[model samples]
Structure formats: C-alpha cells, structure tokens
Target: MQTISKNITTLLLLSVVFSFGGCKKFLSVTPSTQSVNPVTIKDFQEILNSDSLSRTQFFPLDLMTDDVALTDNQFNTGDNFYRRIYTWDALIWNPAQIDFMYNYSYAKILQMNVILSRIDAAKKDALNTPQTKNLIVSQALTNRAWYYLQLVNTYGAAYDVSTSKTDPGVPLVLTPDAYALPARASVEQVYGSIISDLKKAAANTDMPSKGIDIIHPGKAAVYGLLARTYLYKGDYESASLFADSALTQESRLLDLTQNPYMPNQLQDLNTNPEVLLGRISSDEGFFKTYSNTFVIGGSLLDSLGGFSTADKRFSNRFSTSRFSPGVYKQNQLNAQTMVFDNSVAVPEIMLIKAECLARKGDFSAAGDLLDKLRSSRIINYSPSGRTYTADNILSYVIGERRRELCFHGGLRLFDLKRFNKGTPFRQSILRTSYSGTNYAELLPGSVLYLLPLSAYVLAANPNILQNPR
Candidate 1:
C-alpha cells in the first residue's frame, strides 16, 4: 500500500509541471458536440487553471448557497432565491448551477485524459527530460482529482454511513475519452475516486516552496487537499493527521501587525509561509458583493450583539463603514485583486485540526488548538473571556472561522453542509428578500444536496447519470 502511494505521488509531481495553463483559457472552453482531446499541455492547462474556468466550472454552488455571500445578479435566477427558496430556510439550489459545472469539469477531465494518454505514449526521452516532466504529470492528475471533488461535492448527496452505497452521486469521470459519459455512482464511489486521485498526488508530487512564484499548487498543496478530503469523509483521525502533515511543511499566519491590509498585500505574492498552496484561484468576474469596505450582514450583525462595535470579530477582522441601520462593512472588490487571487494559508489547517479534534470529542486538545489561533489574531487572550464551555468553545471556534475566514475563499459552505445547515440562506444580505430567514426554516432532510447534471453533459454523453432530487 505504501509503495503504491509513493509511486502515485511521484506521478502527480511530474503531472504538475505538465499541468501548465494560462489564466484566461483555464476558465472558459467550448466542448465539441462529440468527444475530442485538446492538443497540448498548454491547451489542457488553459482550461483547467483558468480562474473564470474554475469559478464557473470548479465549484458552482459554493457561494450561491452559503459558504460565503452570493454574488448579486440582475439575472435574478441564481443566488437571489436564497431567501425565497430557503423561505423555510429550506435550501432549493439553482438546478442551473450544474450547467457550468458539467461542461467545465468534463472539459478539464478530457484535457487531463489527453495529457495522461500522451504521458503513457510519449518517447521516454520526452517524458523523462526537463526534470519537470514528472511534476507536470503530477499536476495534471491532482487537478483532475480537484475537478472531480468539486463536481461530486456540488451535485452529489451527502455521504451517508448506512445508505451511501445505495445513494445517488455524481458520475465518476476518470478518462477524458469521449465515449465515457458514465452514470451516477453511489456517494461512496465519488469520495473513493477523489481519494484515489489525492493518493496519486500525495505519492508523486514534490512541493516547490513559494520562493520565486507561489500561486501554483505543488507538493504541500496536494497534501493539504488530501487532508481536506479526509475531513469531508468524516475520518476525523486521518483528517487531523493528514492536516498535520501539510502544516508541518508550511505553517505560519500572515502577521496582521506588520503586513499592510492593502489589496496587494492580502495576496502575499511571496507565497508567504502562511499559505500552503497556490496563491489564489480567481473566482469568475469580481465577486459580486465583497469589497475592501465590508458591511455587516444583518444576520451576522444581530448575532454579533448589536453594532459592528459589539462583536470583536467585526471590529478585529474587518473595518466597517455603516450605510443603513443594519448593514456594516466587509471586503470590497477592486483592481488589485486580479494581480493576487485567493490564497489558502495555514490557519485553514489549524481549523481542520481543531474541527477534526472536536469531532473526535477531544475537547481539551481542540480548544487549546483553536484558542491559540484566536489568541494570536485577537488581543486579550483570556481563555474564559468568551464564556467558555466545550460547545461555546466550539461555536467560538466556528465563529472565528467564519469571521476570520470570510471573503478569503475558505470553506464556509462545506461547514454548512457538513453540519447539515444548508438551508438558512439568511445572514448578511443587502437585499431583504434573502435575509430574515432563520435556522428552523432550512429543511435539512430535504433533497437539498442533489445537483442536476447539466444539459450539455447529457447531450455529450447520454450515458452520464443524473443525481435525482
């Protein structure tokens, strides 16, 4: 088992160097009515690495539902329904969310397949030369796995213990072959496939430190992703352990005191030690709502005790400018964002560790691990300051996670779904329609987790299984 894992990791690294794409092409692609393979690494990378591509293709429902604020659209069909559909706090996501996803990911999958096929067939000299050959292959495989993870998470149902084998999930697209539009597998199969990809990544890749350039995923990033996958699997022990592995490589938070809060600074283009992976994955277009000037959402505000002044979170993490009676300030989008996209740093690992520990009922270790994070970012570190109980400690941990991690592109919706809180779309909406909803309104057991397989995918591969609502 161990030997196989190592060989796969080596392959993943070769894949990364092989996985080159430009920002523009990565986001958008028009698939052939019939299955076709892209010609080269550059072509394949263009589609896979694109921010527009990733935003549109990578993970569609993440923001629209509630891991973060939904981008406002005049189109009115998307996140707009957060309030209405979730009127019961019952989350009925846009079926159309699956449209971009199916197209983009399969396009990526195809590109990867072409690369993989070429890798297998290329002359030994071409494949072995440049030292980077292995790196590129490793990258390609990891990215392919990434696409699968996103597709499954959005479209598939939660992985249930007893019924996962019987439950519906997204199609497991391994080969980019045109003939292979597969059917929906069980949720177990989807996760199993993701694990396989990460295992490949972990074994084959060599992490390049954030020395000259830091935006790309290398060894640590893939390992971190593996840790994340384990967490989602509810394998608390493995999750915490894998997260530790990632952290051991790169573990430091951005120094709030010394660093400037200017837009460029947030990127830490240096691939600051704080960041474990690529600098950032650009979301499509500027995020609709988040700005450097953050306004408190009424739900968040009320939860904060009263004024933005009331919660240390509002005061410490964000700089607020008031407009209406309820709304406060949050991140405002502008030009500098393009130069530096979203980057994942070490605190994510800390939270992963803390949460996984808490899940295991190891409250003392979890609380200790979690509080240390709060202690650093915040002033006045009295353990009992926030009225500490195990649950209180956990809530504070999550609250800190929410406040500290917002707009930076961390796991907000994952937490929601993991905890089964996917329905209540209410929090901080400038638009009233989406606000005012509460927890009880969100229908937890409803078919909320399912995502429709897009028309494009169905058209291309009539065989692809649809996740039924």
Candidate 2:
C-alpha cells in the first residue's frame, strides 16, 4: 500500500483481488459449452475447483486500490491495462477488468445458481447427519451472496448506511438463462439479498469453518463477508458481532511470535508467520517486470516521518535502499518477473473487531483494541501515546487501518471512499508511480465509477436501468 514501505516487498496488485492465482491448476469449464445435460452439482463444483477460478472469483479478483498494480506503465483503458481504469473518460471500458467484472462475474453467479437449483436433487437423504448435498446448497447460497456483493461493488455504489435500505442494488440472479436481460436493482435490495444469503450460511451449523473459501463458500468466510457488508452499511454492532463470529473459531493471522524484523527472518518473506490468508501469485506475470520496477518498500520511512521506531511494520517488514523501499522483498523484480509470486493476506478478524467498535462510537474501547494490534506489530509499545479524544478517534482508527491493511486486497480504495479520504491522494497519488490510473479524483458517488452495463446485460432486460450519472 505504501508507494514502497520498509520491509513489505510484494507487489499488492498481483493478488489485489480476493485472490491471486498460483497458476496451480488450469480451468476446465464443464458441459463443454454444448454438452447440455442440465449441469450437475459435482460438475459445477469441479469447475469451481480450478486454480484459475479459485483465484479469480468475485470481490477478491478485481482490486483497484491504492496498493494494486496496472498492466501498462500508465493508466490507459485498453486491453490488459490496469491504469486505464483510472480514466473512465474513454468511450468504452478497457474490457479486461470490465469483462471479468460483468461477464465473468455473472457467469460465475449463474454457475452458483445452477448448483443451488439442484441442491435438493443432490440430496439423497431427507434427514442427514452430514450430507454433501446440504454442503453444496449452503455453500452455493454463500457464494451467491459473495458474488453479488462483488457485483454490487463494481457496478453499484459503495453501500450507503443511510439510504441502503431504500437504495436499489444489483439484480439477485440465482437461475442461469441464455436469455433474459436484467436491470440494476436498488442498493437496498442488493444488500438485502446478500444478507439473506449470509443468514442461510450462518444457520448451517453443519459446515466447517476453516481456511479461505476461494473454491466454494465457508460459513466463517460468509460471516466474514457479512461483517464487511454490515460495516459498509454503518451497522457496527452487527459488524462487530459477525467479525467476532468469523474469528471465534480460529486465528489465521500471520503468527509473528518470533521477532519479525530480525534480518535473517527478512530473507524468507514468503513464510513470514504474520500472514493469515496469503496467496503467492506466480501467473500474474510480475516476475517479468524489471528488478527495479517492483513495488517500493521503504517509502514509509521517507514519507511517514522516517518510519517510527515504534511502528512494527517499518522495523520488521521494510528494508531501505538507495532506490527501492525494500520492506519485505529482499531483492527487486521487474516485468516478466514470473520466477517470483504475488500474495494477499485475508487480514485477521481482530482488526475487523477494532474497526467495527470504532465505527460504533466506542472510542475508548476501540482504542484499546487497536492498540492491542499496534503493540503486536510495532518495535516498541507506548500505550500512553495511543490515547484519543472521541472527536479524533475515528480518524486515528482509519489511519491505523491504512497502515495495517495496506496492499492486502482491494480494501485501500474502498476504505478511502468510505472515510471520504480520496482528496488527499487526488493530486499527490503519484499517478505514474503506482496504481497508475490517473484518476484526477476518486469519483465520489458518480455513475462513471459504476461498471458499464455489459452488452448482454443491456439486451436481456429491456426494463433494466443504467446507473445515474
């Protein structure tokens, strides 16, 4: 997230989505486009099992935050270009990100819907202790919720807590169709459907709560997402409760018990125990980048007042050099840098707890929680300096999130919009340096930022509505 921080060396854009692919498995879509036997559950699940599909699912796949990368040196809306996303001024979408967002996302949504439709058929038993069919249904609902949530974020606006209940959101399509165009739904309706799906996910106690649900849906994962939806809606009490629910069973945070900043430890950036949910993306074509073209790691020391000794991220994670920030990456990389990999850590539930509490007006309590995380991540601990008046506590919380949650996923951009902090970066963002989209400004509540309606989408639903300019 930092232009380049001290120790963090990985390019966040590589895995900026919910996931970055390992190129571990090639995708093989079922039904072969014409085999037409009403796509079975296992067949659909097999498609979901592909490494590409797992890495490129909704919400996680399309991250355009302050931390991610662009395909071109500059932000231009063209084939395979990330920078162009900054300029929606072009007559048409750059197509790569857009096609993935609208066409691919909806296609995935249809896949989930197909699985959901046949969940009952998959169930051979009426009363089962633990059945595969039940798992499929529960997971399908959860996946559907997540996919729609991602769709909403791309095509729709950031969830507005004040008017979301009355706001129109994206269409909640469950069943697949070759024909049948749909219109954009209200934000309220979109969130409503997503919540309903999550409830189904939470209710299914039979499901396990383990690692990332990139392949399918997990109860804990759904709860984790629900927590975000609630946070976006400004419903802190629920957000806190759900975040607690997600983290209650396990702790996936990087286990940084061993001193992280020790130089020897810095050599093995990939295995740093602090990573909770990380993906090393070898297929994103980062290794090909020139060695010096890597994400700057030591920028924090230069920018954030010489990197406070108390800041754990600087002391432990960054390595300063004359050129690059050298935070986590021991060496630098350039385009065609496939020998290396990109990663994403699905941040711990503990941070979300702090965020939800801070949003809820419990500044004293929130500060205590935030400090707990800060202490763990810093070279030195000073609780005395952590005190905050209620007035400035939220700002402090937002700042802490920026530091702790940088370059993890698509979060920085969303965080900027939610707290209304994009103005600071409008001109200062170093558009040519990183996140190359030369967005003169982060569009505040504009229709342009909304995903362009796909041609298929427009043709299907005659009554479908386009986003307002």
Candidate 3:
C-alpha cells in the first residue's frame, strides 16, 4: 500500500511538471538539437490520461453521509480524520491532516489548465491537425469542468440559486500560474464557468467516439456531465434533454443477474459497458478500513424491503462481515481497496431522466424509465404490479436513485444536499455504532452539509473565505 501511494504521488508530480514546465521549460533549457516538451498531440493526451490525476478521493464523502456506519471497536480506534468527518465535526479541516479530496482535485485542475494553455502552441507546431487539436482542447475543457465541479461541491456549498451569489465557491483557477492566489469565486460564477466549459466540449463534433481510456472524457461523457450538473442545479428540462443526448450516444447497462459473481472485482475501466467514464481510488488502506469498519445503516437496509431479495445488488454489493453479526458491509467492487465508479453510468442517467420527467408531470414516461431500470435489477420484476402516478412518481424515482447509487461514488452526500432544499423531500441522516450506544446525526439543511475548506488553504490564501459552520 505504501508503495502504491508513492507511485500515485510520483504520477501526480509528473503531471504537475508536464503541466507547468512542459513546452516552455524545454524550449529554454534544451539544446537546439533536442526535441521540445509535448512535441506531439499524444504528449498532451498522456498528461490528461494520468490514472492518479483522474482517480478522485471521495472516501471521506462516504463517511460523512448516512449510507455507512462504524462498528463499535472500529469507531473507538478509527483515525482522527475519519472520526471527525463521521461526526460532522466543524474542525475537520486541521492543516496537519492529509485532505486527499482537496489536494487531488486541485492537482487535476492544474493539469487541465496547463493542457488548455499549451494546446494552441501544439496546434501551431503542426503536431496535430485542426480537428485533432479541437478534440484535444475539448477534452481538456471537459476535464477542467469536472474537476471544478468536484472542488466546488466538496469545499463549497450546494447549488442553491437563492444564495449562490453570496455562497463561497472553490477558487476558479483557469491558468497554470501556480503562484497566483485567487479569492474564492461565488458559487454562481463557478457553476457558470463549469457550464460554459461543458458547452464548449459538447460543441466539438470531432471528439473521438469514445475515450481511448475511460479516464479520458468523451462526447457522451460531456453530455452526461452536463445532465448531472443541471440536475444538481434543479433544472429538470435541461437535465432531461442532456441525459437523452448522452443515452443516444451510448446506453449500455450491465446486467447484474447475468454476471452475478466475480472474485476481487475492481470495476476496472472499460470493462463494464455501463461505464461511460471511470475512476478508482489509489488509497488501499482507506478502502480496507472502510470495508472492515463500516456497515449499512439499519434504516437503509429496511428500505430495500422485498427488493433486497429480488435485486442482485443487495447480495452482490454487501455481505455480513465476521467483525459483527447481522451487520452488512458494502463490498460492491469485491476488493480490499476502494475502486469507485465515478463515471456517468447507464442506471444513473436513466434515473436522472426519470426524475426530470416526473418533475415535468410526465408520470407515464417517468414510470416507464424507472420500470426499465428496475426490471434490469429485480430478478422477477413485473410491470403490471408497478404503477406510478404524478404525486408518487418523484418519491419512487428518488427512492430508486438512493438504492441504485449508494456507495458507488459519493452520490449519497450529494443527493442529501440536492434533495434537502425543502421540507417535503428533506432528510435527516442518523448513524449508530454496532452496540447502538454511540451515534451521529446530520439534519437536513444543516450548514455541516457544506464541508469547510482545508485549513491549509485558508492559511495560504487569506483572501479565500470558509463555508459557514
């Protein structure tokens, strides 16, 4: 594990070097006979394709949400960082602690910015044709938008149109100037910039049909991201349209029942047809701890109801660990290390479209979409028994979303925030230890839902403001 961590760090450092010093430094330091840095299109693509840079850290996100809980012994002996996050402590941003989520996000953003800044030079050098250059630029823009979306959602507040203008978002760093210390942008500005980047990426028709690797964002991935962003912002019409666009490009659902069992399954990139894009954590120890310490919340298990038997997800994704009896721990990937599927998958897109249709009062259309996904997961699903009306359609869709998306890629926390805007859909999350003696609660609309920026960030950039406690 230590070796793996070192390798990941080395890759990130390499990415940083290429991003900051690639072409310019080579031109200055190399002999006239030597070739310049990033002399070809592949050089730029290689930087964007770094596995370490693309695999985001959202393990802390899983701990902060209600989907997971600690065993009695695990809770007592857990690291301070995990404990603090699990309890929703206001002081979780200690500078001494390693905030992988913050650091990795910014690192990838820097890499994307560097690529975007140097792409023009690559074009002028004739290393890439006009079409290839446009495609490369589009990929960079998509990556930049994705990284910013992760940063703002993690370090800043959820998108609330009423308060977005006043809310502190992550700093919008669009250039490769590492020394520049910019103040945090408003949430509105950050989201607008993300939308703009995605629009540009989507407009590029020459983008490769699919990424050479799942880490490289493709045209469908672009549309999928746009759909996700609009969905988070509560724009149902745009979400539906973009989701439709993405599905048209690529729609492949992994039939869980068909391939029900596999040993040490890590959900590798390009292996799953459902995955339009994919990322997995490099922190092996974090995943081992998560699997050993955490179990599904009791309430969540009950919500599974009959579906727990009919749906292969229940048996496939979880198991009763020897650490505790009757306690179920998540093992979706069937690996000791955490390998999350962060890409836009078919099931997620379907749910997004269903929810949007429900919002627009298209009960029949929404119900059909929901039924299609449900039928895929449920062993003996019968549509005749499943009927949804407008009043109950949204509720059903949201419930299915919870079941389908939990523990995959930190969707639980984001869903909690996005749906907790009002009284009707607001949720209060409760987590209890194995003995049922120790517990934590995160109420709906609580300021704690918005994680604070790392103390290291605030110390370095005095102009940056912290999220409210």
Best by TM-score, which number? Answer: 3
327-379 in candidate 1: lDDT tens per residue? 22223464323222335457777887887776656778778876677655544
* TM-score, candidate number 2: 0.70
Please give the CA lDDT of all the candidate structures: 0.53, 0.51, 0.72
Candidate 1: what lDDT?
0.53
Residue 95's lDDT within candidate 3 is 75
Residue 279, model 3: lDDT of: 56
lDDT per residue for candidate 2 within 379-443, as digits (tens), equals: 45678965676666776776676666554334555554455423332312323434443534434
RMSD of each candidate?
8.4, 10.6, 6.9
User: Model 3 lDDT vs. the true structure?
Assistant: 0.72
User: Ten residues in a row with the worst lDDT in model 1?
Assistant: 26-35
| Clash count of each predicted structure | 59, 65, 0
Report the C-alpha lDDT of model 3 over 322-351, residue by residue, as the tens digit: 545334433455545544456667788889
